[model samples]
Target: MVHVVLTGFMATGKTEVGRRLARILACPFMDIDSLVEVAAGRTVAEIFANEGEPCSIPRTAAAWPRPGPSCASRPDRKRFSGGWGTPRAGRSWRTRTAHQIGLRASRRCSPSAHLRMPLPPMRSTLPSSASTTSSSACAGSWRDGDGVQVVEAEARVTAEGAVQEVEVGLGPRSYSIVIGAGLLPGVGTRLASLGLHGRAAVVTSERIGALYREPIVESLRAAGFHPTAVEFPDGEEHKNLAWLAVLYDRLLEAGLERRSLVVAVGGGVVTDLAGFAAATLLRGLPMALVPTTLVGQVDAAIGGKTGMNHVLGKNLIGAFHQPRVVIADVDVLRTLPRREFIAGLSETIKYGIIRDAALFRHLEERLSEVLELRRDLLVGLVAACCRHKATVVGDDEREEGGGRMVLNFGHTMGHALEALTDYRRFLHGEAVAIGMVAAARVSRALGRCGSETVGRLERLLKRAGLPTEIPGGMTPTALALAMQTDKKSVDGRIRFVCVEEIGRTSFVELTAQEIVNHL
Candidate 1:
């Protein structure tokens, strides 16, 4: 299923366009900002005036992960279907048990997986007969005196399961990230709808290919495309110029051309190497991503940045090549090793720290469920991370401006540690866990954050079974030297991301001496 996501600066007609598009497609329309305003019991201008713009409504919207029934203060329990309702006095929006709404697909719709919108619409403008109630918020319908009822739309779930869609709005480069369980089998049918034809190259690691190759190849063959499987050794150590050269040789041997599609099906390592190859080989080839690991699904595969680690630093040699689509099958994550799964949490934690404080709280509250891979919680977590990533990537596709730099929350020391260890001692996420600690410490020392912030981060990382400190026998001096060669460094000064608080960060340049002082 395809979702049209409208995003831009304020007063950009995103809401109007979204409403019109929804009418044309006969789908539900949601305006997040309007929901925020209703929840706050104030207008957008008032919210901006009372609180800073940064603390305004959108942040509240980002916190919501799913749509459910909402409760209002009205005593009447009358339910209305497919129409507007009037608001009652002293009505306050609150969450209640979810009510099922069955929506039949229009003739224009195509058959595939069920499409669901995790976030439902909020209350809009009210009528004069109803008195305003104190500020409260909910996820579903809102009623007013003018016989206007605002009903939230729910996604259709089949006997199989439900599919959640997140839009990465890059204008012409935009694509949909489909997250759900058991999606790999239908990948072929989905690809066919995207206008892709000709041969397909599936780049994956030997380890992962052994488990998933047959299903993907079978799916492609069922969709009337010839798929060639290319396997490489699995490890960050193997992500180098030599392996890249090998992939190029393999693709050329397969008679791949510009019209052919490159399918990257593995963890972050495979995605980086394969995406880089697709970007450089034949100038560029259309690419699709199927990220298997938690790290890949939530972080690596969604962003357009693709590259292999350089001897000097991680991801130093790469290109900005966006994929045509990303299909994240949660079922595949069940095969991930425990350690790798824990490592992925580091990136998840990074997302919470950089933005989405509510996500951080959710992780803190549901760490056990997340670790156990509860389908409901895990799906929402993945969708939230993707939304955060899509927003950043849409704003800065190239990372030339500082907007995208916030994503490098912990990577300065993280990449340095990886290079210093020669990519052998620690997993990419492990090194990043340590790097985040170092960054938080620096932020505290520079008075950007309080000491409690550092402590909270250390405890969270530790709880996630991650290393929050430089490993024993590893010298800080070596890490500093490696950081000097980091891709983000300029004029020999290492640029660092400083955390002002959880969900708030800024970029700062620090000298080698100053970095050590924070440690």
Candidate 2:
């Protein structure tokens, strides 16, 4: 039997743990680090030097061997499910029960494996509602009127960020997404600067109506355009065809012309619905995107893909409509919950993996600062991500080929997950996070990517408080059915975005069995 022989510095948690482990197993326990330290009090280095013994040792590709038996001997390798499944062997005998039963019996119980991550939690990224406050640390708790309970969130700044220009390329239909947080203060001024005219409307959602309506109305009036406010239902569940009509009817009622501007201020779903509405209304008007969720700032707000999901699939009804201006003010994120913020990071990390490899390096290097909401670091991170996404969108506005498909690196299964749950269980970014992990794993399994790359991606996603695999709610068969229902599926073949390596992704065809194997 393999037994773990702990080998580390003396001050490590070995001795206390050894005692407990020994007690549990009814076996002898040795604190080798303590024994080594006791034999060489001052320094093992000095003893090695005096004895003239070589410190360098043999190395192997595999893990270091135990001095005697291996750690494998201590316990059986348990195939444990996340918070939702059967209990398995753990570090301690009572660990499994202690972890799963530690919290309330509700669905909101934080997964033990999830919390053990070195990074933040998924629940922390989104707030319960729009009125949440910033905290001393990056993680902030939030509650909404509905009591949805996102826990922690980050509302990406709703203002134009650091970029000098907002690229709005559509060939005669092209416009710019201006970068600056205060662009909303003088919404008309910014729109007029872009050479827009007629009437202007602040298109918001019901949840954010109380907090953001009046200022926008006043801003449009100040800018010499007829200003009206339009608010839709709150939350991602209802971001669909029904809500798009509300904005359409309001724009028509306000007498908005082709030259008018539709200022969208809220979350990704809001921008998606409003952006698509503006695209269809008056044959596409100049619309300014003010993304309020972290998912919006770096990803959704800049991508120019707008639409609503169908019961059959996610984002099945969408248009490639570029916003005239995208304002990503960082200050707004303070109101978001910790979970929403972490969820948003999943997309930001996607940009890093697909385009700017340096972004991942920065994320890994400054994880603590990113979680802490360090303004300077976040500003730079947001800007860099925007630039990456903007460049990709600029190249392929309609998602014809390679450039646009890169965005789908993990979305194929992700959309399926969203469809399976009816978009209630996880946030968009959370789904993408799980999708990306599946992509990485599939990439490795299919010989397109390396195992280490998959491991790194999993570790990073977990650190960002994202899920690395499909949660227990969806069974393998159900997951297969959902994937089959994906809109991107062609000729009954489900396509997966497989990674060849870091920063390289490709669309690959797979059978339902292959996809099920991935889960």
Candidate 3:
């Protein structure tokens, strides 16, 4: 329902004003900080002293909803304000659920001047059809020696049930990323809204499909689409042309047409393979992605790059096929193995360093809650990443312009490590973790960044339980050799992404010998 979120800098009397306005409106008052303190069994001061301010934000955000009608408040506006309530100078919060209704309060400038409290910003107002039975408002007020003034803002909430959408701008090939918890059951309805009907093929790995495919098939059937299940072996090793061929055979057997949709229902591997099949089968079919893993949700499935890995190098064979929609149901992450979950953080950490420095600090400060799968924090983190990726992809959908190459910050070395290990030794994320450390070293060697930058990155990776060092028995020469085949390499020179500082990166071309020398 509508939640009048009172947000501002600290000591702004948000709590005091919220309580008074709640009394005036005869509605309940909810203070996020007090809820956090009660849940933590300690005062806010003690939490900051012991656990630091970074930890407090996630805790407060996580605890905000448990005590009834809640309004999220952030003391550090610079970090939390942009993503949650208001759009910052450079960044836009485009999700349907995160829009802000700006409310302003002004006092008299003179005896003749009248106090004014304007209605919520026009952009934030809801549609006329929205019901007001469940609407709520919040106010933050203060008093001076002259007098006391109060400003209150109310929003009409829609009935979307917390589902938020981020659009990937790709002209005719664009799609929306739908994010929220408990979103799986509505997959059929969402697809129906997109005008997808007829026979649909739900492509997934046997392991993931067994757990999730039924609900998807049921949903599609209810939406007037005939659906079938196609399963393949799970894991990166199974992501090959052979499996892709099997998907084609299954689609043919099911009589799926060009208009038929392919629903990718697993993690990164499934998305890559299914998306490629959708791109190629019958010269292309519409596809939708339901990423089950953290890595898929944050990175792989959001981008339009789809491919199958070759023995020589990872993702050597692929195509650019954007999906019709990407449904990221966060609840699936609860069943993820601990190592897989931790591995996903590597990508999250990469996002922070490559573009958003504040996100990097948030990961460092709130590692525990993030690792614990706190719903609010994870949703925000995923949405932020999707936003960043959407912006980069909008500029260079095919990686033609150098704008999108910055995403390869740790990928050059990471892909080499993956190839060297035969896709068996380390997960993609773990290899990227080691690659990031190596890239940082290269940056330092080239005089781009100081040693402290490398140290901070390493420490953050370590805290995330990711490996930062190259595996034993692997030499710099061998790793450099593997880099020779990477897609980013131009001619014989490898195009490496080097970090200059947190949230800043540049691309550098180096010969194999030069890369080894840095190593």
TM-score of each: 0.71, 0.66, 0.73
How far does residue 120 in candidate 3 sit from its true spot (Å)? Answer: 29
Which of candidates 1 and 3 reaches a greater lDDT?
Answer: 3
lDDT of 3 by residue, 125-197 (tens): 1232122213233332443443344442332221113345678999888899988778899999999999989
Clashes of each: 7, 37, 0
The C-alpha stretches of model 3 lying farther than 4 A from their native spots are: 1-161
Say which prediction, candidate 2 or candidate 3, comes out ahead on TM-score: 3
Please list the residue runs of candidate 1 whose C-alpha ends up more than 4 Å from where it truly belongs after superposition. Answer: 1-161
Could you tell me the lDDT of residue 393 within candidate 1? 88
lDDT of 2 at 38: 57
Q: Could you tell me how far off, in angstroms, the CA of residue 109 lies in candidate 3 after the best superposition?
A: 40
Cα lDDT of model 2 by residue, 1-519, tens digit: 323322212122233333433332334554432333355563433433454222211111011223225554544311111111111222232231221111111222222222332321222212221112121111122233422232322233111122234464657756655443444576667767777766788888876667767877777787777878888777778788887777788889988887878889888888888888988987888788888778888888886788888887888888877676787766667667789999999988888777766778788788877888765456667767777777777788776765677878788778888888889988989999999888888777778888888887888888878887788767888888878877667788866778876776777788766877965
Give the 10-residue window scoring lowest on summed lDDT in candidate 3.
Answer: 75-84
Candidate 1: how large is its RMSD?
14.6
Predicted structure with the largest lDDT when compared to the true one: 3
Off by over 4 Å in 2: 1-170, 180-183
| lDDT of model 3 at position 39 | 90
Candidate 1 lDDT, 1-519, residue by residue in tens: 222223323322334434533432334655656656677777655665666544543445442324224423322222111101112211122113222222222212211111221212333323431222222112223233422232322221211233577889988989999988889999988998999988999999999999999999999999998899999999999999999999999999998999899999999999999999999999999999999999999999987889887777788899999999999998888899999999999988899999988889888888987898766556777878898999998888898777988988888888888888889999989999999999999898889999887888888899989998887876767767887788777888876789999899987888766787788
